[model samples]
Target: MSRQHLASALILLAISVALLGALQLALVLPGSDVPAVLALFTIAACVYAAAGIFAWWRRPTNAMGMLITLGGFALLIAGLGNATVAPLEIVGAVFSTAIFAVIVHLLLAFPSGRLDSPSAAATVIGGYVVALPLQLPFVFASADSREFAVASTTQRIAGAAIMISAAAILTNRLVRAQPRTRRILLPLYSYGVIAVLAVPATSLVFTTLGVRGGVAMPVIQLIVLTGVPLAFTAGVLSGSFARTGEIIQLSEWLGASDSRRGPLTAALAHTLGDSSVQLAFRLDKSDSYVDEHGTPVKLHSDTRHRGQVAITTNEREIAVIGYDTQLTARDEDVRRAGQVVAIAIDRTRLANELIAAQRDVVASRARLVDAADQERFRIAQNLHDGIQVQLVLLALEAQQLANASDTPRNVSTRATELRKRIDAAAGDLRRLVHDVVPLALLQRGLVAAVEDLVDRMPIPTDLVTEHENPALTSTVENTAYFVIAEALANTVKHSGATSASVRIDSNPERVFLEVKDNGRGGAVAGKRGLGGLADRVDALGGHFSIDSVPANGTRLIVELPCG
Candidate 1:
């Protein structure tokens, strides 16, 4: 057994010894009601002691366990009240009221052992003063002594004061506690209410009815005492199961594959049974916090409605979980769930980071493709407006010189050759302009432009359209056309291809294009024009890949989103 269990075993042995001593004292006492009085003390002592031991064994860390243990010890000390020895009787009388103080302490500090606030501390302090210091003066007084009246009056005043304080504290706690916390505290509150009423009721009974009241007082005390410990134990058991059950359910929920349906805050709220729960992740680099979507969120104290708990890993705070303020009464439950919450928050942060990275890559690629497109447009415009116009003027001037009647035969022949050369240069410029930004692609569509391109190939080529062309955005059409053009060019230049086939297939969601060459196959992805083609496709949220086998042929595929 552990040291805690050993200590509990030792305490149980001491209680048993004290119970035997109380039994012996009852046998020796002279009064007719001695057995009944001793029975009340013995039963209270046995029940509270057993309850304390059980609590201590079950939850060693909770202050409730030690507080309950102390209550039981106080009852054992109270059992010394009827000892035959005068000194022992005086000691017992001085301390017998201490058990009532302990009960008040236990009720105020249920679930958690520490007195959490100034008001709670003051209440416990007052109970101790009334139960111990105020009762000291009555310790040595005999029942018939002149001082007995003063002692009795002081006892009634102190008892009434302690009971009133306990009632106020219990009422304040219940009023402020949340639904879940109030449920856990219900049993203890019931015990407090009964104790609050029973203390004064017993006094009134003894004062008004005399002998009959004396006959009923022990029975009343026994019932109240027995009920208090039982209620406290019941509350402890219920709270433990409720907390454990929530943790188990949360574990199972998080373990499933489709756990990403809701945000981290919703999952935590459901797990903690607090619908108002909010999660904020700490950004260590910025010394700030953000919600799960990465929007900045400021945290502040609002104890009336919400409570905050920090979640940490590796000794550093990773996030904060804000829950219902009423849960502050059971702060330990929140603390225990912190590890699971931290893991979930960390996972969400990583997923958000991955999405952000992909977004950045797509945006960067789009900017690159836009720059390339602008450069192509500028070159095409210059060829058509400046160089082609100048070439045409040169061709017209040479033709006019060649046709002049006053020109010599040699000069006319030279001018005719110069005109032919100028016309040829103009034709080359026109072809370059067409290659830079194909007019057909902009005016007609992807299919017509690709078909026009394949007809001009140096080797035999086939263009097949699997579906009638649907209207598409300019980016999609331009990207698909360029991907096919680059792949066919690469096949002609590097693959030593004699023939090639281009296929276009389309659906509502996306368009698929495939280019295959019947040539010596040695194609690599992200090489030569393939890399530029891949970038263009990626800019339009498309996929590009190359498959090649040495003996077979190269196949380039592009998939572009159309809708």
Candidate 2:
């Protein structure tokens, strides 16, 4: 035990001895031989004190322990009334009529430890007002005096009224409580309420029934009054068992929930019975926190009446769960509740991270693809406007010189030969510009481009189409063309093939393409042409595959999303 617990134990031990002495004195000095009633009071005080200490250690945030402990001490003090010393007797007389009033206060506060409603607060205040102040008026008076009789009778009548009022308030509160809350409180009501109300009623009702001054009253009072402390202890144990079940159920619920059911934060709060529960994830490589949407959240460590549990995985602080202390009662319970959902929280955080990384890769690929396309456009324009135009002018000038009437025969022949060479060079340059940009694919799309392409191939090829695509994004169209071009190039260079075939299936959402050739193929992916092609296709969220066997023909399949 810590210093705090040791000191508390010592103080309670001293109080127990004192109350034991008071019990002996009250039993011996009494006018009546009602040892059972006196003994029950002393035992009830010690029992209530033990229950209070247990609660205090378990739920330091709750006030119920302090109140129960106060009731126990008051019972001990009131028993001092039986002492022969005048000061001790006066002290006891002042408190003897008020013991029932303290019981009313303790019961009204119950498991939550705080009086929530106005009626509960008023009843406790009124009980003290009537039970304590009325006794003071007759404290110094003679036993036979009119004032003593009036004050004593008035206090009992008022005390009885407050007790009844308190009982009604408790009944209404219990009735209004929700189903889950009612289950937690029902034990206290079933046992403690009966015990608390019967404490005073036995002295009043049992007398008429001819049992109050007999052997039965003492036994009846002892049993009923003892139930008060026992009921609370039962409530605590029952709550713990119920909470364990809830924690288990919480894991099951989270494992099954999806978008329609809501997020984990809401589920955790509901499971723990504390609505003010908060969950936030820690940023990677930083001591900061963020929500699922990546919104930065401040974890207020200094906030009052709230406690936090840091959830860790792989020696990293992945998330934190903060809960209301007054509402939750125990930090260990919150930590246990967090343990139940640690895996779920970590999964969510990792998923968010992967999604973010994939998004960045996609964006970078798009930039690269767009930059390469723009550079191709620039080169194609330069070949057409500058080099091709200059070559055409040279061919025209050479033709004019060769056709001139004053030109020599040798000069004419040489100029004609030079003109033919210029025309041929310009033709080669035009073909190079076409390869760079593939204007037909941009203007006429995949079908027309492939038709023109296979017609120029050195080997015989077939083209098959299912749905001529309506339209597609430039990125998707570009990647599709590249897969076909690169696959055909690989077939030409590596495969000893005589024929090739191209197949296309297109829809609004996606386009599928297949290129197969009858060749002695032993092809593999991640090679020269296919490696770069695969990366380009993946950047656009597409799939690329190459199938080849030594005897079987090679086939390249590409699927590109349209939108």
Top model number, TM-score:
1
TM-score, candidate 2, is: 0.47
Candidate 2: segments with Cα more than 4 A from true spot? 1-246, 250-339, 458-460, 466-473, 506-511, 525-527, 538-541, 561-563
Give candidate 1 regions above 4 Å deviation. Answer: 1-243, 252-339, 458-477, 493-499, 505-511, 525-527, 535-542, 560-563
The top-ranked prediction according to lDDT is 2
Provide TM-scores for the models. 0.47, 0.47
What's the CA error at residue 116 for candidate 2, in Å? 37
Q: Model 1: how far is 107 from its true place, Å? A: 28
What is the C-alpha local distance difference test score of each model?
0.74, 0.75
RMSD of 1: 19.6
lDDT of 1 by residue, 1-563 (tens): 44446577858765674666566456435664557667667667767766766665554434565676677767666666676767767767777778778888888777545676788888888888888887876776677877877877886787777677777777787899788777767766776667646756787777787655354676777678767776776665455633543554466556767645566676676556566677778766556777888666888667687788888888877888888765334666776666765677777766655555566787677767767788888889988999999999999999899999999999999999999999999999898888788989878888989989999899999998875677676667778888888888888788888899999999888999999998888788664478867867877678888889985889988898874
In model 2, pairs of residues that clash are none
